[model samples]
Target: MKQTTMNRTQRTVCTVLAAAALAAGLSACAPLIVGGAVVGGVMAVDRRTAGTQIEDEGIELRAANRIRETFGDRVHVNVTSYNRQALLTGEVPNAQERQAVEQLVSQVENVRSVVNDLTITTFSSTLSQRSNDTFITGKVRASLVDAQDISANSFKVVTERNVVYLMGRVSQREANRATEIARGVSGVSKVVRVFEIVSEEELRRIAPQPAPVTTDDTKPSGG
Candidate 1:
C-alpha cells in the first residue's frame, strides 16, 4: 500500500511539472512562422493542412497590417485566423470603428469568414489587463493539456477581456470537451467555441499519412 501511494504521488508530481512546462512555452499566445509554416508545435496535430495553415497566417498578417495602417492607434484589435476563419477581438472606440474593423478584415484576401467579437469601449485594454488575459489563456491551455482525453494542440486559444475563444477543426465531441475544460479554468470568465465541426471519420480521413518506409530490397540500382 505504501508503494502504491508513493507511485501515485510521483505520477501527480510528473503531471504537474509537464503541464507547467507546456504552459510556460505556450504562454506567449503567438504562433511562430518558420519557413512559411506554422511552427508552434501544433503543425503536426493541427487538423488544418499545410496550405490552409499558411493561408491562415497570411490572413492574420494582412488583416493586422491593414487595420494598423487605417486605424493607427485609434483602435486596438487582435486578429486570430484559423482555417481561413478570422476572429477579431479587443476594443474599438465606437460603433462605426467596430463595423469598419470588421469590414476591413473581411476584405483581406483568402479570408472565408470573420467573427467580430470587438467591444465598443472608449479606451483600449490596459497592458495589465492584457497580461492577465494572456495568463488566463495559458491556464486554460494547461487545463486542456491535462485533460489527456483530447489533443490540446488541435485548438487555438485566444483571450480578450477574460473571454476565451477556441478555434480549431474538431469533431463535436472534441469541441465540447475542450469547451468544458476551458470553462473550468479559474480566470476564464467565458468560453467561446469557434470550431469547424467535422465527423470523426472525416477527421481520420484528413489526418496526415506517414511516409512509406524504404527497404533495402526496394532500393533503386544506379545505372
Candidate 2:
C-alpha cells in the first residue's frame, strides 16, 4: 500500500510539473516531462536550439512590452524573433514612429538584427483584418509542413495585413521553396523572406548527426 501511494504521488508531481512547464513556455522541459506529442511538438519540429527558442521568446516579449508602454494604442506592431533577429510588422502612424519602434527593438538584449517592415499609415488594422491575417499565417504554416522538400520547423511565419513574413536560418534552396509555398497560400498578399542564408555544406555541418548502428552478434548461426 505504501509503495502504491508513493508511486501515485510521484505521478501527480510529474503531471503538475509538466503542466507548469507548458504554461511557462519552458520548451526544453516539456519534451522530457510531458509526452513529446502533446506540449513539445513545436519545440521538436523547430530547427532552433532549445536555448535559442527561449531567447527568441524573451526578445519578443520584452520588445512588445516596451512598445506598448511607449505608444499605447496609437501604434499597432507585431514583433517576432528568430535566432536573435527581430522582425517588426504592422502599421505605425508615421515614418518617425516606425523608425522609433525599430530603434527601440534593436536596443533589446539578445536582438542581433531588426527587420523594419512597419508601414507608415494613418491607422492600425481592424480586428477583422487581424483575424484574417492570423488565418493566413496558419495556412502558410500548414502549406510549409505539407511541402516535401521544405522543413516546416526551419521557418517561422508571421502575417500582418495579408503580408507574410518568413524568418529562419536556412539554405537558399529551402528559403526559396518556403517563400514559394507561402506565396501560393490563399490570401497572402506578399511574402517577405528574412532568412539568414547558409550554404549546403554549412547546413550539413549544423544538422544533427545520426547515431551509429550496432548489430547484436549473440544470435546463433542458422543451420
For each candidate, what is the lDDT?
Answer: 0.83, 0.79
Shift of residue 63 alpha carbon in model 1, Å: 0.9
TM-scores for every predicted model: 0.81, 0.76
Model 1 weakest 10-residue run by lDDT: 33-42
Clashing pairs in 1: none
Task: State which candidate has the highest TM-score.
Answer: 1
Give per-residue CA lDDT, model 2, range 121-142, as digits (tens). 9878999998898778767766
lDDT tens per residue, model 1, 61-157: 9999999999999999999999999999999989999999999999999999999999999889999999999889878876776677887767788
Q: Give the TM-score of candidate 2.
A: 0.76
**Best-matching candidate per lDDT:** 1
- Model 1: runs farther than 4 Å from truth? 1-44, 210-223
